[model samples]
Target: MRRLDLPPVWLLLFALAVLVLSRLDPWSLRLEGAAVDLAAGLLIGGGALLVAVAVVQMRQARTAVLPRREAAHLVTNGVFGRSRNPIYLGFVMLLLGWVLRLGSAPALALVPLYAWVIERRFIRPEEEALARRFPQAFARYREATRRWL
Candidate 1:
C-alpha cells in the first residue's frame, strides 16, 4: 500500500464534519449547562495537550512528524514513551469533546468509523514503514507502548 498520509486539509475536513454532526441545535437539544461546557473544555484541553506533546517529541527526534510517514529514528521516549499514536489519540479525544459539547448521539457513531478509516488507510502503512526502517527499535517500542490509550 502507498503511504497513508492524511494532509492538513483532510484532517481539518474530518474535524469540521465531526463538529457539524455533533453541533447542538438549540431548538432540539440545548446544551447551555455549565457542566457540559466544563466537560467539553476538559476534553479539548486534553486533546490540545496531547497534540502538543506529540509535536515536541517529533521535534526532538528531528523527524517529519507526519502520520503518513515514519520517523527517521524510532521515537520511544517522551510522549511516545506512553502512546504509540499520540496524534490519533488527540484527534479521538477532540472528537469526543466535540460530541459532548454538541449533545449529539450521531456524532458518537462517527468515532468508530474515524478510527477504522485511520487505522486501515494511514496507521498500517506507517507501521510497515517503521518496521522496515527500524525493525528492532520499533519492535521494542511496540512492546512497551500501547497502540491506543
Candidate 2:
C-alpha cells in the first residue's frame, strides 16, 4: 500500500501544543477532591503507560511504527490487540490528563480539536492503508478491537 502523507513536523507541533495548553492557562481548574485527582492521575499515568506499550510494540513490529509516515508493518498483536491506535489514544489520554491537571475549561478546548485533526489527518488514512495492506486480517482485527479506548 502507498504510505500516508502526514508530516512528522506536524505531529511534533501538535505534541508541543498539547504540552503548552496543559500548563499555560492561568485558571487552575481543580477537580472536586479525590475524584479529580484520581481521574487526573489515572489519565496521566494511563497515558504514560500506553505510550510505553506502544513503544514496545513498535520495537516488536519492526514495522508498524508511528506518525503515519514511518509505518513498516501491520501490527495486530500485543497492545495492538487491544487498541488499533494506541499511540493516538495515548496522546488523547495525555491531553485529557493535562486538562484534568489544569482543570481549566479553556485548556480542554484543545482536546476536541486535537481529536478532529488526529481522526482526519492521521487515523483515517492509516485505516485506509491497513485495509489495503491486510484486507482480511485488518477487518477481523477491526471487528475485535476498538479504534480507541
Candidate 3:
C-alpha cells in the first residue's frame, strides 16, 4: 500500500476526524449570535483567500507548493511576506472556522492539534530544506516573517 505522504492529505484526515467528533458534541455548547456566524464566515473566506494567494505566488515563482519537494525560489512577497507558512495558517483558519460553525467546544481542540501536526510533519522539514538550499536568504526571511500570523 502507498503511504499517505502529503501534508494536505494528513490535514484532510485530521479535518475529517474533527468533523466526525463535531457530530458528537457532548456539552452541547453553541454560540447563538449573528456576530459569531459573521466571524465564522470571515474566517472561512480569509482562510480560502490566504491559501489561494499562497498557491498563486508559488506558481508564479515556479516553486513547488508541496512541502515534500524542493522549492525553486524563496517566496517572500505578498501573502508569503505576512506569514512564512501562509498555507498552513490558512489550514488552521479553516479548522477554526469549521469548529465555530459546528459550535462544538470539543472540536476546537482539533485546530491546535492540526497546527501541531502540520508544524512537526511539514513546516519544520521544509524550513530545514530551505535553510540548506538558500542559507542566507532563508535566514533573512525567517528573521523577517512570523511562522503563522
Candidate 4:
C-alpha cells in the first residue's frame, strides 16, 4: 500500500469540494422537502453500515485494510459478496447523500468523479494484487461480485 494513498482522505477532499461547489449560486438545483432529507439520511446511514461491516470483516479475517497491501485471505461473504470494494462503494454512497443534502446540481458531478478516482488510484491496483495473491479465488469472486454495486 502506498503510504499517502488514503481513501478516506480523498473522501474528505471530495466532500469539501462538493460543499464548495454547492455554494455556487448559478448551478443550484436547490432540492428541498422531507423526501430529500429522508433519502439523504438513508443513504448516509446505509453507507456507514457498509463501511463498518466491511472493516469488521477485514479485521476479523486478519487482513490488511489498506489497498495494494498483502491480504491474509480473500473476503467473499457478507457485505463483500455484494461488492468487491464495499468501503469505496460506501464512500460513494456517502458522497451521493451529501450531494442530495446540499441540493446542488453541480455538486452531483463530483460523486462519480470520486468513484472514478478511487477505482483508478486504489481499486485497480488492489485488484491486481489480489489476483496475484489469490488467483483462482479472486477470479471467482470477481466474476460473482461486481467491482461496485
Candidate 5:
C-alpha cells in the first residue's frame, strides 16, 4: 500500500481521535459558555479561510500543493508570504478549535503533536525539495516568511 503522507489524512485521524476522546469525557473539562462557542467558531472559520487562500494561491501559481509532488513554481505572495505553511497552520487552528469546542484538555495535547508530526513528516521534506528546486528564490522566501504563523 502507498504510504499516506497527506496532511489531511493525519488531520482527519487526529480530529476523529479528539472527537472520540471528547465523547468519552475522560478527564475532560466541560466548560459551557457562549464565549467558548464563539471562539471555536472564529477559529474554525478563520482556519478554513486560511486553507482556502493557501490552496487558491498555490493553484494560481500552478504549483503542486501536495507534499509528495514536485512544485512548478515558488509561491511567495499573499498568505504564502505570511506563512510558508499556511495550510498546516490552518489545520492546527482547526484542531485547536475542535479541542476548545470539546472542552477536553487532554485533546488539547494533540495540537502540538499534530504540528510536530506534520513538520517532520511533510514540511521539512517539502522545504528541502523547494530549496533544491528554487535555490535562491526559496532562500529569500524562507528568510522573508515564517514557517507557521
Candidate 6:
C-alpha cells in the first residue's frame, strides 16, 4: 500500500475542516475585519515564499524534498540554516492563514494539530534519516539549529 499519510494530505484535509467548521461554528466564535484579511494574506504569502525557498535549496543540494526519504546531502544553509524544518513550518503558516481566512475558533485550533501531525509523521523521521546519513554533520547542525522557528 502507498503511504498516503503526508503533510500536504493533512494540510488539505485540515483546510477543508476549517471551511466546514467556519460554517458550523458550534463555538460561535468568528474573527472578522480588514486586519484579519491583511494578516491572512501576509501569512499565506510568507508561507509560500518560505516553502519555495526551502524547496529550491533542497533541489540545489540534490536532496529529497519528501518526508521519510533519503537525502543525498545535508543542506544546512540559507533558510535551512534558520529553521531545520522550514517546509513544515511554512505549511503551518499556510494552515494558520487558512484558519484566519475561515475566521472560526475551531479552524484556528487546527493549526497546532496540523503542526503536531507533521512533526510526528515527517520531521522526526526526516531528522532520524539525516542523523543516520550524516552523523557528525547532523549532530553539529542539530545542535546549532532549532527544529522549528
Q: Quick one: best TM-score, which candidate?
A: 6
Clashes in each model (backbone N, CA, C under 3 Å)?
Answer: 0, 2, 0, 0, 0, 0
Give the per-residue lDDT of model 4 (tens digit) for 11-91: 999999988888875845787889988989988999999999999999999999987679999999999999999999999
- Runs of candidate 1 with Cα error greater than 4 angstroms are 1-8, 23-33
- Candidate 2 structure lDDT: 0.74
Candidate 6: deviation at residue 77, Å? 0.5
* Each prediction's whole-model lDDT (CA): 0.75, 0.74, 0.85, 0.90, 0.90, 0.90
Instruction: Give the local distance difference test score of model 5.
Output: 0.90
Between candidates 3 and 6, the one scoring higher on lDDT is 6
TM per candidate: 0.82, 0.76, 0.93, 0.95, 0.94, 0.96
The 10 consecutive residues of candidate 3 with the worst lDDT sum are: 1-10
**Candidate 2 vs 5: which has more TM-score:** 5
The digit string of per-residue lDDT tens for model 5 on 1-149 reads: 34675899999999999898788876656755899889888899999999999999999989898887999999998998889999999999999998888877678888999999999999999999999999999999999899997
Itemize residue pairs with steric clashes in candidate 5.
none
lDDT of 3 by residue, 1-149 (tens): 12577767877887788778878767776655787788888888999899999999999999999767899999999999989999989888887887787666787788888899889988999999999999999999999999997
lDDT of 1 by residue, 30-122 (tens): 445788789888998998799889988888879978765557787777777788888877877777787777776666677677777777876
- Superior candidate under lDDT, 1 versus 6: 6
Error of 2 at 107 (Å): 2.5
TM-score of model 6 (CA atoms):
0.96
The global Cα lDDT (0 to 1) of model 1 is 0.75
Q: Which regions of candidate 6 are displaced past 4 Å?
A: none
